[model samples]
Target: MENWSENHNDFIDYERDEKNKKIHILIIYDISENKTRTKLVKFLLGYGYRVQKSAFEAIVTKSQLKKIIKNISNYLDEENDSIRIYRMYYDDVIIFGKNFSIEDEEIIII
Candidate 1:
């Protein structure tokens, strides 16, 4: 029988696509400037991303993700802004939910 390590190695042996699929990503940004956050949210939505409870999730291509992130980064205030990008897998949100309460979950992306 194959050992666990052998099985893991077998799994890793398969060829995987380097290109990112149209996977959903959660993007969290801190835009303390009045109306800045809202405007940016609108911009993302207008570009085909969805915004939920201050978290944005969308099926973005890898190239598009880079462009979107660049646009967002450009708008951020160097000293006061930040963005958290999360790759949304099947259970990531549920796993994280264990540590964050419902209210706390409001700010999370994945």
Candidate 2:
């Protein structure tokens, strides 16, 4: 079998173009090791806003999502760590606290 990492670029490009739409992604992860968890959280902070201690929300393109997953996977211990990415439509996401909102056309990450 071919290695997934080897073919990921092609897959990312094709799917990104075909699905050229913005998506709301919620990332949640649990890591037992402090160093790894800190590294993962810092990495994620570069891509999204932290909504909670261990959760984040971002408006991302398909390509960005693919990249995020591929990069974050490197920090995970397959047997001990867990990461959950939830994809939701913009309109389908409802927020009830802190007035959190995602822009339709863009996300300005400072």
Candidate 3:
């Protein structure tokens, strides 16, 4: 789904280590309206994001292809829009044999 994201074109040069897994997050919404907020949350949740309040997080062994479906839903809305992507170093230190390393990433909006 990242490819379908607004700034997806800008990620061409960036690289991720295939040996070390990482979690990528994308959040988009209109802070001024409840309808958009609700829609965004529903869409994320419908796509399996563990949502809590205004935030959602999820981790999986392999990238979920359903992610693109979630992103595409954003366009069905007629309101103006903005999207944010945050990639974080994912760690499962408590459980051995289960983990992924991530590079420092910034919140990107486009």
Output the TM-score of candidate 2: 0.71
Prediction 1 global C-alpha lDDT: 0.54
Task: Look at candidate 1 and give me any clashing residue pairs.
Answer: none
Q: For candidate 1, write residues 47-97 as lDDT tens digits.
A: 344444566665555555555655665556768876666656434556333
Worst 10 residues of 3 by lDDT: 101-110
Model 1: CA > 4 A from native: 1-20, 47-51, 95-110
Candidates in order have lDDT scores of 0.54, 0.72, 0.44
Error of 3 at 36 (Å): 2.0
Better structure of 1 and 3 per lDDT: 1
Q: After superposition, how far is residue 80 of candidate 3 from its true place, in Å?
A: 7.0
Pick the TM-score winner. Answer: 2
Leading candidate by lDDT: 2
Cα lDDT tens digits, model 3, 30-67, are 44467766666665654335433554554322334235
Which regions in candidate 2 have their CA more than 4 angstroms from the true location?
Answer: 1-20, 104-110
